[model samples]
Target: MYSIVDIETTGNGIKGNRITEISIFKTNGYEVIDEFTSLVNPECEIPYFITGLTGIDNDMVRNAPKLDEIAHKILEITADTIFVAHSVNFDYNVIKNEFQQIGLDFVRKKLCTVRLSRKLIPGYNSYSLGKLCSAIGIPLKDRHRARGDAHATMLLFHKLLRTPNADKVFKSFLNAKSQEATLPPSLPKAEFEKLPTTPGVYYFKDSKGKIIYVGKAINIKKRVLSHFYDKSTKEVTLCSETSYLDYEETGSELIALLQESAEIKRHYPKFNRAQKRQVQQYAIFSYEDRNGILHLAFNKLKMAPNPLHIFYSITECRLFLESLCETFELCPKYCHLQENVESCSHYKIKQCIGICSDLSYTKEYNERVVTAIESLEETKTDYVIKTKGRTIDEEAFVLTRRNIYVGYGFVSKETSLTHLDDFENYLIRQQSTLEAQRILESFIRKKEPKILKFTAETTR
Candidate 1:
C-alpha cells in the first residue's frame, strides 16, 4: 500500500509556516484505493514568486477550507499506507506540521520516489518530478500543483514496484530484509517523526539512558536522516543501539556550538572524538624569568592556568608559537623551549629582536610581548560581521561590542547596526571555539564584506 502525497506551502521553512494545498492518492500494489485533495486556506499570503511558480495565489485559497477542515479525511485516506512522494520528507513534514498545528498527529512509514528511482534506474541527470517523468516517458500534467505532483509520484511508484530487485529494495527500507538483526526495542517510531530539519543538537542514548553520542547539525532532521541512509558499519551499529533520542533547538549555529561544547564536556558522550583527552595538553604561556625579561612560549610540560591560548595538540601550539616568534621578533633563547645556543637559532637569520644576544633592549622585547598579548585579548571595541542568510533578501550579522564577544542576530539587507542597543540585542552570544574563530578569520581574510572597519593587531 502506498499513499502518494504532495503539498504546496506558504514557504519552504517550518518555523510556523502553513500549508496551502495538499493531495494524497492511496494505492494498493497495482491500483488506486482512495484519494484526497484540497486547496487549504493557509491563513497567510502566498508570496508572489510562489504563485508564479505554482499558479497558486492567496486570492484563490482565501475562501478554501483550512487544513483542519480536511485533516480527518486525509488521515482516513492515508491510513495503513506507506507514504510516498517525489521527495517524501518535504511532503511528509508539510502534512505533519499542518496536522500538528491542529492538535493531530500524522505518522507513517515513508518512501522517496527520487531516491528509489536513482537506485533502480541509474544515470539520470535530474530526479525532480517533472524532469524525471519527462525523461522516463511518464505523462505529468498540471506541473506544480499538489494533485499533479502526487499523480506523477504515483506513476513513479508503480514503475519502482515493477523494477528488478524491487522486492529487495522495499525490504531494505523496512529495516527487516537483510538479516534478523534486532533494533533497539525501546525506541519509539515517534522519535524520528518529530525531528525538525532546523539547526540544533541531537543526543543518542542507550537502553539505560546513558548518552552514547552527541552531535550538532545545521539541520537536525537531514542529519538524522543521513544516519539512516548510511550503509556504514558504524551507522548500522549506532542505529541498532539508539534506544532514545533527544534534541535541543538552537536558533543559531553559534548557540549550537556553545551548547555542544558544554554538553559534550558535561556528559562525556562515549562516541565523541577521542582527542578530548588532549584539550589542555598544549598552551601558549607568558612568563618573566629571574632576569625580569618577558618571554612568550608554547608550554607542554604541565597543565597551567596562565595559558594565553589553548590548542588540542602540542604540535599545533609549537607551530603557532614559532610563527609568532618570527612575526613579533621575540628571542627563542628566553622562551626556554630551544636548547643550548647562546644567541638562539633565529639570530642567525636576523629574525629575532636580538634580546638573546643582548643586542636588543629588554624593554623593546617586552613591549612586543605585551602587544601580542593585547592582540589576542578579546578587549577590542565595537565591530560587526555580516553573513548570508538562509534566504536571498535576508542577512545575518555577528555583532561585537567593546570586543567582549557579545552576540549575533539577523536583519534585512536594508537594515544597519547603527542603533547600538537594537544591534546588541540581535547579537547572539557564542562561546569561543576553533570553528567560530576559523569562520571569522577566513571571512575577514577573504575581503568580502563591505568593510565598515576592521584592523589587524600589530606588535607594538
Candidate 2:
C-alpha cells in the first residue's frame, strides 16, 4: 500500500514551514482505495506569494480546521502505507514536522516519484510533477493544488509500477540500507557513487553546474553522504538544490584544508558561509614609552607605525607575542600581553628575565627586542611544505614566498623538489587570502610537515 501525498506550504523552509493544504490518495499500486484532502489553517497568516501560487488565501482556511484538528485523520489514513510524493522528502518532512509540533510522532517509509521516475523512466528533460506528467501524456488538473498534484502523482505512480525492472528497483529503494530516498531528487545516484573515499575537497553544484558549497574532508564520499543525512535547515536546503557532485583528491588533509579555503574565497559559494568575510589585518610594532623603554604592541595594520609583523586575527597576534616573549626572555608586560602590571609575571611566560621588574635591564631587553624584530624579516624566506599527493607516485606541496601563500601543486615523485624552482612547472598559482594563511599556519604549527626553506637567491 502507498499513500500518495502532496502539500502546499507557507513557503518557509523545512522546519519552520507550515502546511496550508494537504492531500493524500491511498492506493494499492493500481487503484485508489481511499482519499483525504483538506485546506489546513496553519494558525499563521499565509504569505501573499503563497496565495498567489496555490490560491489558498487566509480567508479560505480561516474557518477551515487547523492542522491539529485534521492531524488524526491524516495519521489514520497514512497508517500502514508507504509515503509517496513528487519530491518525497519535502512533503514527508513537512508533515512529519507538523505532527511533531502537535506532539505526535510521524514516521513512515518514503518513496519519491521524482527519483523513482528517473530510475524507472529515463531520459526526461525534467522530473518535476508537471513536466514529467506532460511528457508522459498524463492529464494533470488544478496544478499546484494539493489534490491535483497528488492525484496526478498517483496516476503517474500507476504507470511507473508497470515499468520494466521496477520491481527490482522498488525492492532496493524500500531497503532501509539504500540511500536513494535520502538524496536530492534531481541528483543521480551515480553522481554520488563516483565520489572517492579519500582526503579531498568536494563541491555541491546545482543543475546548472554552479558551485553552491565547498567542503574538505579526509573521506570525501563519507562526508558528502553526511550532508544528505543531516536534518539541519541549511543542509536540507543545500542538498535540495544540489544535483551534481565534483571533487579533487589531495591525499593530505593539510592540502585539502588549504584548497577548501581558497576555493571558498574564490568562488564565494552561496552555501559556504564561512571564509566569505574579509580577514582583518593586525600588525605588531615597537614604540618608546615615557620611561625610555622600548615596548612591543599590536594594533590594526592601518593604525600601527613601522609594523614589524602582520597577522590575520587578534588571537594570532597575541600568540605571536607570547612566543616572542618566551623566546627572548622578555616581560609579557613590556610586550603588552599583560596590561597595567607593576612586574612581569604572565601566567604562561615565567621565563621573563626581570625586564619589567628592573630598569637597569632596559638596554639588554631593548637589544633583544631588536633581534626579535629582525627575526620577523628573516621569517619571510621562501619555503615549500611537502605533503602526500592524490596518488602514491606523486607528491603535493604548498608554496610560500616572502611569508605569503603562493599556491599548491602536485608533481611526480621523480621531480626534484630539492629546490623551490622545481615547484614552478606544476604549481597552480592562486591569490593569497587570509583564510589560506590561517589554514597553512595552523597546519604548520600542529603537524610540523617537512618544509624546504631557501632565500630568493637560492630559487635561481
Candidate 3:
C-alpha cells in the first residue's frame, strides 16, 4: 500500500513554515483506493511570493479547517501506507513536524519517486514532477496545487512500476529498513539509540574512549547507522573496533562542518585520513625579484616565510598555481613548474606575457600578481559567523580574526557582546586546522551572513 502525498506550504521547506494545503491518494500499486484533500488554514500570513507560486493565499484558507482540526483524518488515512512523494524528504518532514507539534509521532516508511525514477526510468534530463511528467506524456494539471501534483505523482509511480527491473528495485528499497535493526558489535544499542536526528557532529570511539573517527550530518542518527551498513574494509574495521559514540548538537550545518573539521584535527582520528594531516604541506608565497617585481611562487609550506595561501597537498597547491599562472599570465618557469629552461612553454606559446623574458614590465606583471594574491586571500577579513543555537533564546558564533579561526561560542539573545574582549570571553579556543578555515571561508562565500560592525558588544 502507498500514500501518495503533496503539500503546499507558506514558506520554504524549513522549520517554522506551515502547510496551507495537503492531498493524499491511497493506492495499492495499480489503482487508487481512497483519497483526501483539504485547504488548511495555516493561521499565519502567507508570503506574497508563496501565494504567487502556489495560488493558495490567506483568503483562500481563511475559512478552511486548520491542520490540527484535520490532523486525525490525516493520521487515519496514512496509516499502514508507505509514504510516497516526488521529493519525499520535503513533504515527509513538513508533515512529520506538524504531527510532532500536536504531540504525535508520525513515523512512516518513505519512497521517493524522484529516486525511483532516476534508477528505474533513467536518461531523463530532470526528475522534477512537471518535467518528468511532460517527458513521459503524462498530463499534469494544477501544477503547484497539492491534489494536482499528488495525482500526477500517482501516475508517475504507476509508470515506474511497469519498468523492466521495477520489481527488483522496489523490493530492494522495501527491504532496506528505515532504521537500523542492529548496531556495531562493540557498541551499546542504548548509546546509538540516543543519537539525535539533528544537525551535529558525532564521534566514533574505541573501547579505550579514544576517538577513531569524527563526522558531521544533518541527521546524526541516520548517518551513524549508515556507517554500520557499509561493507567496505575500512568501515567494517571501524564498526568492529568502535565501542562508544559521542555527539554535540551544532544547530546549523555550517557550524557542524566547522566543528567536525576542528575535532578531526584535534583528535587525529585514526579513521579520518584527509583531516588528520598537519595543517598544510604546501603554500603560495610572494617574493620580490631584482627587477622589484612581486613574484607569486609555490613552495613547501615550511620554507615559505609568509605564504598567501595554504593547501593540504602538493597536488592541490600545484593545481591552484596553474590556475594563477593562467589567470595572471605568469610564466610557468617563474612558478617553478619547469627548471633549467631559459623560457617557459607558456612564453613560447604566447600565453605568458613574458615575465620570465623581461618583456613584461615589473609594474604591469606585479599588478596581476597582486590581483591573484588578493583573490586567494579569502580569509583576510575579521568577522563573526552568527547562527542559531541549540536552544531558542541562545545563539552561536564562530569568530575569525585576520584569517585565523579564533574560536566558536554561544551567547544569550538578551545579551550583546560590546567589544572584542567580550566576544573572546565566551570562546573556547582550539587549534585551527586548514580544513576548518576552508570550511568557514567557503560557507561565508556561499551564504553571505549578515555583517555587523562591532566596536562594543555584550553577550549573556
Candidate 4:
C-alpha cells in the first residue's frame, strides 16, 4: 500500500516555512482506495513569490482550517501505507513537521518515485513531476497545485509497478525498516541504512547535491552516525542541511586518510575547517655548511628547497627534529633548537657529540646527519602498496614512482599487476601533492606494505 502525497509550501521547507496546501491518495499500486486534499491556513502570511508559483495566496487559505484541523484525516488516509511522493523528503518532512507541532509523531516508511523512476524507467531527461509525466504520456492537469501533482505521482507509481522486476524491488523497499529512529530528520532513512561499515571516505550533501562535509573512517557507517549523535551546534547545523550521503570504500585506512585529505583540499567543504588549508606549512631540510658538514634544519615550507620531510605545523617539525637529534646525537644548535650559542645545552649534558664545539670531526658528524636525512626520506623508487580490495577475491594497490603518489585501483586475483601498462590501464591517476607524500611516507613507516618494485625491464 502507498499514500501518494504532495505539498505546496510558503518557502523553502526549513524551520520558518509552512505547508499551505496538501493532498494524499491512498493506493494499492493499481487504483486509489481513498483520497484527501485540503488548503491549510499556516497562521503566517505567504510570500508573494510563493503565491505566484503555487497559486496559493494568504487570502485563499485565510478562512480554511489549520493543519491541526485536518491532521487526523491526513494520518488516517496514510495509515499502514508507504509514503510516496515525487521528492519524498520535502512532502514527508513538511507534513512531519506540522504533526510534530501538534504533539504527534508522524513516522512512516517512504518510497520516492524519483528514485524509483531513475531505476525502473531510466533514460528520462528530467524527473520533475511535470516533465516526467509529460515524457511518459501521463496527462497532468492543474500543475503546481497539491492534488494535481499527487495524482500525477500516483499515476507514475502505477506505471513503475508495471516495469519488469519492479515487484521484487518494491517488496525489498517495503520490507526495509524505517531508519528515522537513528538518522537525522532531513536525510533519507533508506539512504543512511545503505552506508557500508568499511574503511573509506564519506561526503555529506545538501538537498542540491553540494558536498558540505568530507570525512574518513575505519567504519564509514559508525563514523557518519556519530555526527548525528553529537549535540554540538555545528553538528546539528550540518545535519540540518544534509539530505543525502555518498561514500567511496578504500580497502586500507592509509588510502582512506590520503583520499580524505586530498578531497578536503580539493572541495574545501564548508564544515571541514582544519584540512581546508595547505598541509605542507613546515618542512625539514638538509644543507652543507661552510666546513662541508651536513646539518638538518626546520623552516617554513616556502623557504625550503626540496625538503626531506613535510609537516603541517612548526611544532610537529620541531618535535621531529628533536627526536632525530636524540636518535643521531646531532647538535641542537644546528637543528635551530638553541640559537646564538657556541655549544648547545645538549653538549653540556653530554647528549650531543660536541658537533656544536667542533670537538667531533665535521666529517664524522656529517655522516650521522646524512644517515638521519636518508632515514626520513621516502624510498626514491617506483613501487606499489598492495592491500585488500572492496571484496575478498580482489586486491587494491596504491602506485608511486620516485616517491610521488600516482593513484590507486583494484584488480581481481586472477589478474597480475606486473607491468607499466597494467598500472596505466587500472590506476586512476591523482595529482601528486605534498600531503599525499606525507601520508604515503607515514603509512609506509608504520604498516610497511609489501612493495612491488617496477622498472623498464619489467614493463617489456
Which candidate ranks first by lDDT, i.e. highest?
Answer: 2
lDDT of 1 by residue, 105-194 (tens): 998887777667766786876666798899999999999899998898898899889999999877876563431112222344456667
lDDT of each: 0.71, 0.90, 0.81, 0.82
> How would the candidate models be sorted by TM-score, starting from the highest?
2, 4, 3, 1
What is candidate 2's lDDT per residue for 1-460, written digit by digit as tens?
A: 9999999989888888999999999999988999999999888888999889999999998998999899989999999999999989888888888899989999999999999999999998888889999999999999999999999999999999999999999999899999999998889999999999999999999988999999999999999999998877898889888989999998899888888988898899999988888788899999999888889999998899988887888998999989998898878898998888898778889987787878898898899988888888876778999899889899888899878889989988997765678788889998777878878888889988999898766788
Expressed as tens digits, the lDDT of each residue in 320-377 for candidate 4 is 8899888888888887788888878854334677778874578888888888887775
- RMSD (CA, angstroms), candidate 3: 19.1
All candidates: TM-score? 0.45, 0.79, 0.45, 0.54
Instruction: Quote the lDDT for 42 in model 2.
Output: 87
The clash tally of candidate 3 reads: 8
TM-score of candidate 3 against the unseen true structure: 0.45
Better of 1 and 4 by lDDT: 4
Candidate 2: segments with Cα more than 4 A from true spot: 278-376, 455-458
lDDT of 2 at 389: 89
Ranking by lDDT: 2, 4, 3, 1
Error of 3 at 352 (Å): 6.4
